[model samples]
Target: MEYRVLGKTGLRVSSIGMGGIPLQRVSEEEAERIVNLALDQGINFFDSARGYTDSEAKFGLVFRHRRNEAIIATKSMERTREGILQEVEDSLKALQVDYIDLYQLHNVKSLAILEQVLGPEGALRGLQEAKAQGKIRYIGITGHVAEVLEKAITLGEFETVQFPFNAVELGPTEKIIPLAQAHDVGMIVMKPVAGGAIPDKNLALRFLMDYPVASIIPGMDSEDQVLENAAIGRHFVPLNEEETKRLQESIKELGNTFCRRCEYCMPCPQGINIPMVFLLDGYWQRYGLKDWAQERYLAMKVLADECIECGTCASRCPYGLEIPRLIAQVHRRLGRN
Candidate 1:
């Protein structure tokens, strides 16, 4: 596997580490198989969070027997002293591990949240106490927002920072990555595929690997997905100049099929599965997995059939996506079934 230095933590993580979100939807046995396959294939770094329902708990089942084999990174968004301590204890118990390799403050969505985390009675003190007690090896901070992440790193001694770094979201490179590199802090890239919206997975890996981040973690729930992600690590070759130019061109040239996962365009008045519609739309439009995507799209219970044309989702969307139009498109394509 191609290993990169995880900045000052002095840990070498694979080019593609396992993201822990998809485990929420999978069975314990299924998660075990997927995680074990990744480890067997040289994925040592496993990232999880307390909020990802049953993810850490499911991982605990796998790690119980292979605790010494993998690097476990988990996070909590809790920003209280007692809550932080309790979260750490609960995570340790859930993972069945004595300590976490990396403990992160998850998803500091705003500058205010960042301050509250480092402020008095915040999670920072609790993290320090946990580190003092040898409960966590390193401290990391993650966020989808750029300003908050930059502010978090500027004010604290975070060893790692996780942010969305993909073809569409290059904000981190311009915002927090350089600062993290300057501070010798690791960058754990999340949503390399924009939560599975990006179709060319290999290209996505090559794109992220071009930058000097610690590693990129993509969620894998099945053996095929595990093999698919681990393949990038096993034979990782950064994009060539021409390939890079081609990728940039592709990004600029995209006519359709990309979901930012901003979730701003939510609360669809029609109960028309907007995100899921777009998700399946992306699967077909980008990956050309039409049959599978079509099947899943047809399974939606509260589908595009209910879109009342109120345009509330469109108003809420940060990207200004045409929610009603997209719902109509999904209804036309998949509503019959």
Candidate 2:
């Protein structure tokens, strides 16, 4: 696999790092197979988060023996200094590592949350303390919102930033990326496939590889998928003009339906999270995989079928979306009615 220097940290990271979100979905044995196979392919960067449910422990099981041979990064959402300090200790014990290569603020969602982390007694102070104590190398932050992430960069000196970047979400490439680059920050991409929405995986990955990013973490879950992603890594192809046009067209068609998850069209009078409800809706509608995702949607007690068509959702929607109508359509499509 091709590698790039991870910004100022100077660690050589794989062009495609192993994202840890999906590790929570597999058995320990399956997770081990996937992790080892990734290492065998010369892909050494593995990222995890405490919120990912034993993902760090699963990675620890195999890599603890070869710690020096890999680069591991993990994160937590604790906003308090004491909470963050405890989180670092917990993650170290779980990952079985002396120090994390990069530790991050896990999705500081709002301006207030951002301020809390950067405040005098805030979590970033704890992160700074961890670095001084040899617990973490570089400090960073990750979030889905470009503005929030840009705000994070301005809040303090961040060593790295992990946010969504793909054919579907190029807003970062245009804005957030250049800002991070100017700040000399490492740029790692998360959800490069738009949470599995892009039908052609290699095409999606190649689009990201075209950029000068430190790495793209695509959540490798199996040996086969690892090999497939690795093969592309060895080749490192960029989409040609025709292919790029098709990919852009695909993105345009899938764009607004994809729910950037901005929480903009929110506070549905019927208590629906307009964006989240529509995100699940997109999973069922455009993907034509309702049966595959139906159980998960059904399991959510706040299913969109409860939307009352009070027009409040539409009124508050910055994008001027037809909120209640779309919710009904999605509910009917998912048979959640």
Candidate 3:
């Protein structure tokens, strides 16, 4: 596979890495097969999160033996020093690895949240401590909001920055990508296929390869997906004129229907997490993880069924999506409604 130096960290990683979200849908044996196949195909970077239930352990099963051949990365949502410290220890135990190659501040969604993490007793202190103690090699940050990520990177502490950048969700182009390139920070793209919303997988991945990114991590659950994504890295094909046109067609079809998870349409007077509900629905409808998605949807503090049809979220949505309608659709499929 073609490799690039993850900016600032100086770690060479595959152009297309393995995302750990979909692993939650597979069995232990199947997860083992999928992960090992990825490694055999020369996909060395594997990213997981403390919140993606057992995803770290599933990776640990294979990484334990192939530790030297893999670059393991994970993240936590904790904002405090103690919380992040405890989360890091838990991550190490779950991954069955002594030290993580990269540990990120998971989804720093807002400017306030970013400030909390960078403050005196924030998670940055915990990550700094872990780096000093040889528990983690480098620190990074991941989120959906370009403005928030842009603000966080200006502090000059993060070694890398990850966010959703794909054919449809093109918000990062406004400032996030330029800022990261200017600062020499590694750019790790999370939703390369727009959370499976993009129909043509190869076309979607090829679209991302055109950008100056360290890696485009597309989550894989089956062997076929692992090979398909790995082949793009191994063979390294750029999207031709026809292929680019096809990708653009798909992106146009999605239009505003795709939720970019920018979180501007938040604080639903009803307390509903608008983007999160759509995210879980994407897992069910696009990723074919109905049961897993439903489980997570039910676990949420506020669900889609709680929407009161105030139209406030829809008004705030920059994309002009019919928030209440989409919420109802997701609720029917994944919620108690």
Give the top-scoring candidate (lDDT).
3
Which portions of model 3 miss their true places by more than 4 Å? 299-301
- List lDDT for all candidates, in order: 0.82, 0.82, 0.92
Q: Encode model 1's per-residue lDDT on 10-110: one tens digit a residue.
A: 98888789988778768899998998899899998999999777999988998989988888999998988789999999999999999999999998887
Looking at model 3, residue 266 earns an lDDT score of 84
Off by over 4 Å in 1: 241-320, 323-337
Winner by TM-score between candidate 3 and candidate 2: 3
TM value for model 1 = 0.79
Clashing pairs in 2: none
Which prediction has more favorable TM-score, 1 or 2? 2
Runs off by more than 4 Å, candidate 2: 252-256, 267-271, 278-306, 311-322, 326-337
Instruction: Tell me which residue pairs clash in candidate 1.
Output: none
lDDT at residue 122 of model 2 (Cα atoms): 94
Candidate 3, residues 25-105, lDDT tens digits: the string is: 899999999999999999999999998999999999998899999999999999999999999999999999899999999
